[model samples]
Target: MAEQQKEMSFLGHLEELRWHLVRSVAAIFILAITFFAFAEQVYDHFLLAHIKPDFITYQLFCDAFQLFGIDSAFCNVSFADKKLQSIKVTSQLMNSIWSSLILGLIVSFPYLLWEIWRFVAPGLTAHEIKKSKGFIFIASFLFFIGVLFSFYVIAPISIHFLYNYQITDAIENSFTLESHIGLVTNMLLGVSILFELPVLIYFLTKIGLITPEFLKKYRKHALVVVLILAAIITPPDVASQVIVAIPILILYEIGISVSRRVIKKQEKNANKS
Candidate 1:
């Protein structure tokens, strides 16, 4: 079993943790300032890109459907005159600041993970630490992939469907700036965190809190939960829900493999000892 190198006083641990948190915050602050400098461009080009009818995702969807000789609704939608409303006087400025901060956190995630690992490494056994050397890179890669998947695939589809859906022609769709930003950022961050399932499962297995058999037994329940999560994150449409659920289900399967590997390694170590 892995063991701590040495015991540290409670205050000593707290102090070390404080410094790691401070550095992490400083990195986020620096990136936030940089993003704020180019706030307009970031908002227009990246954050609000889906609002445009000709965004690459929509075009991709159009092309994909065209390959089947089928027409896609994405190609027919237009957002030329549509504008997100700013009801409050401080809405724009506040939303911009918050959005930049969120972007900073997202961009600086790898650094944040490194800081966390540094803080935790001191208490871990050398073997454990060495084995986890790729934690930061792997976690960051999964997170960024999740962000891209959500942004390019889920976000635009949900946005277009929700924005265009109306009960009657008498009612017009007017989305607020704050609401729009909230939706975008939530989906980006939320899905990114969800992508850490395999990592989380690895640790859980290492701690003996869960095993491969347990995960396999609960596979059906996991599917139901994934579907529920998909419903929450996506617009109220079967196609959108299925689209979101597929990746999460894939992650859950990956987590199962991770758990199995962890159990096999543990058994091998036990036999060797």
Candidate 2:
């Protein structure tokens, strides 16, 4: 009887998990369709905005330099006649569908996390639950911040360098729809996932897998790695590399702090038990 009951219980849990997965996916699809409906606006306003010289980031930098009595040739760029083109008729249609899906996933991230939390909460103890009470919110907040950072900071730097780059006066820079969308989505998702370092550290510390000391001891090595990653993601210029690397290193330090707090909480929970 005990064995049979355990099997039934296992199946029940699996069924519940399946439902959660279904609902989360359903939400993503629904949101994706909604975005696809307004695909033209999304492409023009959000996805391709960074390519425009008068986009807010470029404008803000131009204004800042002027206000501070600095002169930069980059500020006087002409955005006209610079547009991404699709070589094939199918490319535009395909990218529109995929880009909408990506945006849908990002916008629905908080809800997706909530669904994950709901599924995982049942397996945790009261102490564990309390300790991780803010996990979803903190994780979602960092993810969105990373998305914004990539969109506003990294994307602009990359677009500025790439769009303006030319081999010679005879050559022109014509970007394909695929290449443009690929770069944007890659940066957006990559940085957003990287920003979960603190949450990752907290969980690792809770499980007694990593410590603050370990992270601190390897800090220099981590800096090198961060710079390498920044170089890969952003423009090859030192200025762009430094801008992207700074926030990541800050997040690593924050991860160390989170690890320390997780240790303290684990010790307290041990004492209570």
Candidate 3:
């Protein structure tokens, strides 16, 4: 009888998890449909904005150089004639659907985190639940910050450099729509995930997978990894790589502090027990 009851409980948990996943997917689907409905505006105002020569990042760079009484390539850049080609018959339609889905996932991230919290809250103590009350908001904030940073700063610079760069005057830069969108989406998703390092550290610390001392001890190694990641994500330029690495290194330090706090809390709880 007890074995049958245990099996039923296991199945019940799975059912509950399935429902949570269903709701998350439904949220993404609804938002994706809405974005697809306004695909033209979304692409023009948001996704493709970085490709323009007059993007905010370029303008900021121009202005900064001017303020310092220096001439900059940013001031001379122009993208009025550059256009993305649709090489495949279904490229536009497919990219529209995929971009809408990615946007949907990004916009619904907080709600998805809420759903995850709801599912996991049942297994946590009151103290743990209270401690994590702001998890969704904090995580969502970091994610959006990363998105904006990549879209405005990283994407514009990368697009400008890659689209204009030529080994010689003979080779023309004609890029496909798929390639352009792929780069933007990948950077947006990748950097956003990277920004979750502190949250990930909190969980890892709570589970005893890593400690603050371990993080500090390997800080130099982490710097090398961060530089490599920056190189992968940013344009092949020292300035771009440095800009990307700074924030990630800051986040790593923040993660170390978070891990220390988690250790302190766990020790306190152990004493009470």
Candidate 4:
């Protein structure tokens, strides 16, 4: 009877999880359909906006150059014969569908996080759930901030640098639509997840896998790794790499602080218990 009760309980949890997942999927699909309905605006003003020479970043660079009384590449207003091509017949349709889904995922991130939290909250102690009351909000905020950072700073810089780079006069710089979208989407997703470092650290600390001392002791090594990661993710330029690395380093520091706080809280709670 006890074994049967355990099985039923497990089945009930699974049923609850299924509903949460179903709701999350429905939200994503709804948002994706909405994005698809306005795909042109999304493609123009959001995705391909950085390809223009007069993008906000370039304008800022132009202003900075003028302030220094120097000639600037920012004045170069034309991309060299850059047109996006789709080699396969279904490529455009597939790309559009995937892009819409990506946009949906981004837009619905907070709600998705909420659903996940709701699903998991029942299993957690009341105190634990209370302790993490702001998790969804903070995580969503960090994610959106990271996405903006990627879109405004990293994506534009990377696109401009790569589009302008030339090895020989023989090669032209016509990019495929898939390639361009892939780069933008990957950077957006990657940076947003990277910004979750503090939250990840909190959980790790709670589970006793990490401590403040471990993070502090390896801080220098972490810096080097962060720089390398930034170099890998951003354009092959010092400025771009530095811009990407700074936020990640800050996140690492924040993660260390979060770990320390979690440890302290756990210690206090233990003493009280």
TM of each candidate vs. truth: 0.95, 0.93, 0.96, 0.93
lDDT of 1 by residue, 106-223 (tens): 9999999999999989889999899889999999999999999999998999899888889999998888998888888988998888888899999999999999899999999999
List the lowest-lDDT window of 10 residues for candidate 2. 72-81
Q: Output the number of the TM-score-best candidate.
A: 3
To one decimal, what is the Cα RMSD in angstroms of model 4 from the true structure?
Answer: 1.7
Question: lDDT of all the models against the reference?
Answer: 0.90, 0.87, 0.90, 0.88
* Candidate 4 local lDDT, residue 60: 86
RMSD of each: 3.3, 1.7, 1.3, 1.7
Write model 2 residue lDDT over 1-273, tens digit each, in one string.
999999999999999999999999998899999989999899889998887778888877788899989996558867587877889979988998999899889989999999998899999999878966787889999999999999998888777877877879999888888998988888898788878878888878877889999999999999999889887776667877788788999999999998988788778978999
Q: Please, what are the lDDT tens digits per residue for candidate 4 over residues 1-273?
A: 999999999999999999999999999999999988988998989888888777898888788899999998876756647788899999888998999999899889999999999988988998879977899999999999999999988998788888888899998777899999988988888788888888888889989998999999999998899888877766678987888889989999999999999889889989999
C-alpha positional error of residue 25 in candidate 4 after TM-score superposition, expressed in Å: 1.5
List ranges where model 1 is wrong by over 4 Å: 1-8
**Candidate 1's error at 182, in angstroms?**
1.0
lDDT of 4 at 270: 95
Candidate 1: C-alpha RMSD to true structure equals: 3.3
Of models 3 and 4, which has the larger TM-score?
3
- Which residue runs of candidate 3 sit more than 4 Å off their true CA positions? none
Q: How far is candidate 3 from the true structure (C-alpha RMSD, Å)?
A: 1.3
For candidate 4, the per-residue lDDT at 133 reads 83
